[model samples]
Target: MQNRSPSRRTVLTCATAVAAGAAGVVGVTAGPAVAQRRDSRLKNILARMSIEAKIGQLFVPYFYGASATSPSRLDQERNLEELGVRTVAELIAKYHIGGVIYFSGWTNNIHDPHQIAELSNGVQRASLALPTPVPSLISIDQEHGVNVRIGSGATQLPGAMALGAGRSLSDARTAARISGTELAALGIHQNFAPVADVNVNPANPIINIRSFGADPRAVGRMVAAQVTGYQRSGVVACAKHFPGHGDTGEDSHTGLPVITHTREEWERIDAPPFKAAIAAGVDSIMTAHLQVPALDPSNEPATLSPAILRGVLRDELGFDGVIVTDALNMQGVRTKYGDDRVPVLALKAGADQLLFPPDIGVAYNGVLAAVRTGEITEGRLDESVLRVLRLKDKAGLLSGSPYASRREVDRVVGARGHRLTAARIAERTTTLLVNEGGALPLRGRQRRLLVVGASPAFPTDDTRTTVPELARAFDGLGFRTTRLATGREPDSAKIDEAVAAARGRDAVVVTTDNVDAASPQRTLVSRLLATGVPVVHLAVRNPYDIAHLGDVPASLASYCWTEVELHAAARVIAGRVEPCGRLPVPVQRADDPDKVLFRSGHGLSYGTV
Candidate 1:
């Protein structure tokens, strides 16, 4: 399953000019027109501020400040208590931190709509207590699907890849708007979303299912849509993982991934979506922790590479927006430097805001020391503070108390209309990959059906393959259904149990998630296909499952196993809705690279030849 090329090495590699650009680092200087438009109010405030407050503004640390004493699983995993600070008020007042990013552990154990609103208000009120009264840029990864951090009281719209499968620009816009609308209602100003990675390599461990698609133009179109959607609703949309994280097999969370494409290839494959995002006037761009030697030969990551961040993104792409780094706590950056040193390197590399530094006190002190020693110049720090302040001003945080009312949070978060919009996107994105001999549109209510469940087939999957809910959706359609659940791949005993149950059934429905990655799931499906009953295969994760299970009479992909998506899949199965979704990524035959089972944009229509 590992799809790395040995030719692509771990060390930074690039051409002469590209390497020279890294050394020269030419984009930090602002042009005359840009300088002319600088906010006079912000400049005056910056001139008056002390170094402590200025350094604080540059760090956006994560907060584990909910009153719940019992730590959630994420809290235990991240060791949130080790950071020392407890409440938002305490952290903001002490560090005078510029902003806060909320992770689920903050309130998962005791998350009420009113409590969340109160927490957000408290954070802002603490910021208001500061000398300059700079309201924090309250941010979350409300990216709407799998990447979402706040899910309980929010609209569960399909993720970026699902929208890509639907292939409707309007749907993409709607998803973003709904996410923005809901987050703004929660008093959150920034959303780290609309993953701009092109997902060129299917073997990519992280960006898959999050990215829009493999094609550059398609990703560009969706990225622009999401940005417009979020910003139009007053939520700052942060396009992420710049230049790109699409082609690497390594997950930057655990290890540093090196993207080995040449500068020409980088521009051709990875940079287009970011270009489109910048042109669309995105509010911020988050740097990836991975290394792109083509953009910088100094062996530094994109987060700490001036050539990639300033020369390419800021100067060449002309993006004057706030440049934020991906979480500083992630091992991608942490492995190279200690908590104290990372902030200085990130700032020196042209990053405006240091996000999620593991130790806020250390990171803050590090930046302050760097400023005093002239490692980070006063003017350079001002440039970033100016951009961050401008974004806050645009969000209307500078004018008054930036707090969400409990009444508004109750009314706007997960509103009925917003839920419908999410459902519609899910319905539209249910792709029908293969339907041989017209095996779908199962009729005859009296006929019995067999439903079998398999665990998610991801090469490294932790998510469950939702079965009972899917079976219930089918049962509601009046099929005399019998449900059976098995491990990702059944033991011989379970397979025997399934085969015996399939004998009298009129049709068989198998639910799978990422079967191509798990050999056991493939074996189970192939065995069931041997049965004489018509087999309907539903792939719940990656669409590549269909290319592997080609012999199944009918195959469908719902992208993810969310309730809305499973409901939409049921409608398609029962002939209540037509199959309209196309493939976002190609279904390449692993055995035959030249033979693609299904191309991108290929899908079947109901009752069509």
Candidate 2:
């Protein structure tokens, strides 16, 4: 799954004047009169747009393939006629799409930096060739850490909670700036990142490690810093799932979750980070596909609720920027409105951008028909399209040249300096949660070092693949290590094998992700502890596994399972680096749900190991 080029080297290749606009660097410097002229031009463009074209300007859809003339996945999925067009280039030209979102893997829209740069230029060229020539904004979800979409050759910085654990706003800013710089270089104008949801509920299925932490102030500080870093780096930063998607146990991608926060409580927990992002001049705020009865009593999804989007987010929070709807195809937003009405309702709800409708044609016609029938006013339609144009102008897309330098991709992206910064950030994110009887830091041991690894269940992965890399991480440090991959979740056979393998080892390290008290991972760790062998339980996703496992001999939370993060964890175990990361959220006592086993900001360090 590495995004390789024609050559077998890394995927970081592509270059020249990026976002914020210098070559691949975005620079939009305008005074009052300059701003006035830019707005005048965009307004003029809007005035000339036909009702059909104007509606298209409000939609940002994703298409399959790496070129203008390739096959499609969505066309087959929908069995629709409009999507029958060949290649994403055709989709853009045919629909006059205002924006395009790129995804790697299944969509195959991106492969390497060069391929992505070509696609960026190709799509932009297609849009500009139109008689009216509306430049489309290119965007992606390069959130870094576990939620990353773009792979290597890009700096994979620590996730939000990991940065929160580091407690350094400067590092946070640097990480975002580096990530933004590379993404902009690839011609991606918008980055759906810096998750602003305050993760108050540990059972929060989606936002756990994606959010900074539970504390309002901490989340706000990191969110504001990241937003500034991203904008300053020339990529438009979007603070998302507004009003809060942090407290709900259900994930909105599959199910509609309701947040019952009172207006006062919402202002306390969920509002601060968004307020901070707005203060920092975030370009957009994405609406959550969930219900907030406290904000809108009608119980409509936030994406379709005028009370929440127009009332709270617009009037109360004062975010004059573009409000983009979360994927309209998701069940959360689709359940209440049919395909035709969803796009129209989002505009009515104050969303300036309609993202990923099931069918782009259906969405376009829906909004167009709504305008013709007076269900939605032209004035309302004008507001959203104008905001989109302004965003384009802000990204220097309207000025000229949306193409990324194919040659420059290699030098600017995943450069040595960026990799070092990522490594340092990873080093600062290793939170030592438990260390009983000094069981960790197995240095210079005579016996072979035994390892039992398991992958996190949240993001599906096989620990067996990472075993060689893990062994190499320790082997590079001059230690003889034996490794075993017990799958993501171990059965009786794997556990028995792991216990048997640990008989004469210095220490046993097992990686856990969201494991529970009754889970097989708990049984594995307990068996390893009973064998008179030191055991280290590593929680690679959420730190809450320690609380659930209850009284493990030793535990550490890397907060993610990235190569750099795992290497940092290995260094800490070998006494190479001190674990400075504190708990971003409180770890509750398994026996008592009301009481905490380890309070927030708790971290253990080995002295003179």
Candidate 3:
């Protein structure tokens, strides 16, 4: 194996490499007039495309293989059959489907970078065989920190909240650049990321740690930097869930969320980050499945509202790039419209691309029928097709060979330098919120330590736990460690069992996950604190756990459950690394009514004490 770990000098060299590569990624820049003239090729291509091809350009359907257990060699053939095509080339020749979104279910081999690159090449070859030879725009949800749709061949960075706490615009750029370069190496063209939503609502179940932080200005700046970084690395950067999904309590995956803010209120709070994203030259913006009566009086979600998608996003914001809908299969859109009607409504509502339509065949036929019956005008359809073609042209899909080599993919994806960048961000963002009685650094002669709480696991990852890795770190420090978890809130018997386990321990270290919402976990921590043992609580998920912990002598927030973050927390405990991270999001105690326990931007350094 290669030495895998790089020194600081090597990391800086990687940063400079990114800076050099960025200048060539989004290389084409011309004034509005020159840009319009450049679209003549796109227009000529559109003039040649048949009605079926034009309609196909508007739809991006998802493809998942028949089973996850299928071998890699059989996947393309199996997927073709499942997609109702005899061969890969027939997908374009027959249905003329514009693009296919790859889900993990698409193949068991989805995580292999070499395999992914080969798949991209195969798809491109199929597209090239068509009469028009227009290459497909291969895309993925490579949103890091959270929702990494690609795995095994990618670096797992700490989530958006960690980046918020890291608090460096340059770090934001470097992180995005690293993510985009790996994606491009895998022959992926678009990254649906750098979530622009300002996470103001702590109760928001979905966008919690995925968002940068609660402050609008900070979110705007960070997402703007990410947009620049991604586009400069040759991947289309999509700022999503516009105008914003930050404050809503509902998950759009299950139901259509309603945001009741007025137009002025939206401008003040929800609209700033999106505005910044557009200003940063974002290539695409994904519409939210949200209903804002203030923007559009109709009950329809933004995905189907012309007033929101066209009037607000396009006319007001002056965005001329591709407009994509959030996955149409989600209940947010599916519940309102039938399979056939969803794509038609989205296109009419100004979406340039219909992503993840439930049934590609039905959606394609429905769009073709609408255009022929005058339900959708030919001119209207052409406008979106032209925009799609322009984007494809800008991405160099029309001009250059859209194939990546396996060797390059191996060299770039999750390379040592990129891993180092992720580690540095993880190290810097682990915030220390409370140390009431000099309880951290484990300075005492206590040789026995008890570790308790939730198993360390990221919200996006379910395979491994950070507990064993964390235990080994403590073991390396010469502390005899005991690990315990009741799996749920302990009853009398379970509590007695835990108390027995804690009897001989000198100090207790508890790792918390979502304790703000998990009352049983909260109660368990309080009970442990009452034992008069020095309990040092490490919150491994949401930082709001500090609110529930309530002066537990010592508490730290990791904002993630990844190994890099866990190891960083262990180093903080062992006094090898100082805890210098500040809180990016505020914490409010349920017992206190008037004040925040720890304000946003508040962090403590060991040297300061």
Candidate 4:
């Protein structure tokens, strides 16, 4: 549904002239003469804008074309123009949107980094073409390493676990810096990255590989380094999913995941990374949708809680930057409060901007209605608008040259420098979990090898190619390799066939996760071990997977099954790469069922050399 537009005369007519009077007061503020003049000019411009326009500025919604997920059946741009639509640039000119957040999955044809950059810049330019051109607060989730949306030619770095395993803050900083530079070159002014969640829950479905490690201090330290690097590269960095989304076992994407913890525990375990990010001067903070009863017993998620966003994040934590809500359409928020109330509640609860509201027209009108009804005052709108404008100014969006040249974007998007940086970070972050029985560096005479796992597959919609990439890397290193897939569960016949196939082989490599304990793959591994063949079980999901396999002659936990990690694993298994990675998290032994097996940092090495 479209917004109701008031007559031009009615909009031009002030209801109370309070905004004008306040604008005058701001205009006459005594400061250095030059500063006063600029402030007066800004105040005058703000004064001329209607409340609807101002509120519209604070509501940034996600826009997608057919090329993104599906092309728009209707011509959104033509419709918007016909509606006197305040494009994002107009919002900047009128209300000053804090920034635009880019989600890769929201687009239709973003097959690679270059396309993403092109599409984003094209949109930004179109938005800027509006009258009284204003710079857009262009943002994207280019966290690189992993969780990257711009895949194609972009350098795919290792996940956060790899960085924690590397144990090098410098490497983390370098990774962030490279990512920031690439983002900035693509006309992106902000990066929602360096997920600061302290991964205390091993069962966390979404944030496992995204977090740096289980240790709060380690996660905090690495986040701080990354923040420093991103800001240094002139891209405002955002540390996200506040109040911690890492401790929950469920994914918030599908439904509301309640985090049951006391305020004390929350303060102890979930607050460090945020504190560190704030101290490092992160420019923005994104709220999570999880329900934390201890923080706000009113049953409101942290995203819509004044006690949390205002009292805790702003007043208590001393964060003065923009407070952005997670996507309003996500089930966590939408399923509870409904879309009509999100903007009003979020803004009133202290969020400065609503990120990707489900319905922009509804959000715009709802917020405008709230302001008109005094649910949210015009002053509140002004406060958020000013913060957004200031951020735009800082991002050089207001410097009159809001768009980067296409050539400049081309030069930066997937530069060799970025790929090399990603590769270096990936190489260092690769962790080696176990090397029992000195079974690695297989004898030159031993040519038979069997590799099995779900990790090796073509990059299809359903699966990634980490395992296949590793297998190819092994082939490059001169190893004769045989591949097998154990579809979450190995077939009994297939298991027996694989066991028999490996009888005369020098070694066997089995990749599986303990989390899938009930799967047939675990049973397959046990049967293979029964053959007395030296089995090198690579725990690709979590080190805890080792607990399901009992005692094997050799085992390794690479933590994540990303392509780079698979390559690292292949090198270590073939003795081409030394095992430098240590377990960043604990591993358990199946025999000692009740006892914890490998503690954090516990991983056996074949030898230093």
Most lDDT-accurate candidate: 2
Using TM-score as the measure, name the better of candidate 2 and candidate 4: 2
TM-score of structure candidate 4: 0.84
Question: Residues 1-609, candidate 1, lDDT per residue (tens digit)?
Answer: 111121211111111121212211111233465444436656766776688988888888766645323244565444446556555576777887778887674434225556666667667667766776666888888775456666566778888888999999999988888888778777788888879999878778889888888899999999999888888777888999998999999999899999999999998999999999988888899999998888899979889888988899889999988899999988898777888998898888889989988788888888999999999899898999998877776665554446677777778988999998888888899889888878887876426888886744221123434676677788787777888887666787888888888888998888876665455677678778888888889987788777676578888988777667777898888888898998888878967857788999988977773
lDDT of 4 by residue, 246-301 (tens): 88988887788898989998888889999999988787888998889988888788
Which residue runs of candidate 3 sit more than 4 Å off their true CA positions?
1-24, 66-93, 105-109, 444-448, 456-461, 472-480, 485-497, 592-594
lDDT of each: 0.77, 0.79, 0.76, 0.67
Q: Clash pairs of candidate 3?
A: 145-159
Give per-residue lDDT, candidate 2, residue 441: 72
Per-residue C-alpha lDDT of model 2 across residues 1-609, encoded as one tens digit per residue: 122222111111111112333322232445677657666767777877777777878888877777654445563343235465666667777777888888766566766777777777777767765556776788888777678777745767888999989989999999999988888778788999889999999889988999899898899999989988887887888998897899999988899999989989999999999999988888899999999998899999999999999899999888888998988889889887789999888898889989988888788888888999999888888888888877776776654556677656777888899999888888898888888777777756633677676754222223324555566677887777888878667899998998899987877778876787667878887888889877778888888988877567788998887777788888887778888998888888788879988899999888622
The number of clashing residue pairs in model 4 is: 15
Better of 3 and 4 by TM-score: 3
Kindly provide the TM-score of model 1 when superposed on the true structure, using C-alpha atoms: 0.89
lDDT of 4: 0.67
Where does candidate 1 clash, by residue pair?
Answer: none
lDDT of 3: 0.76
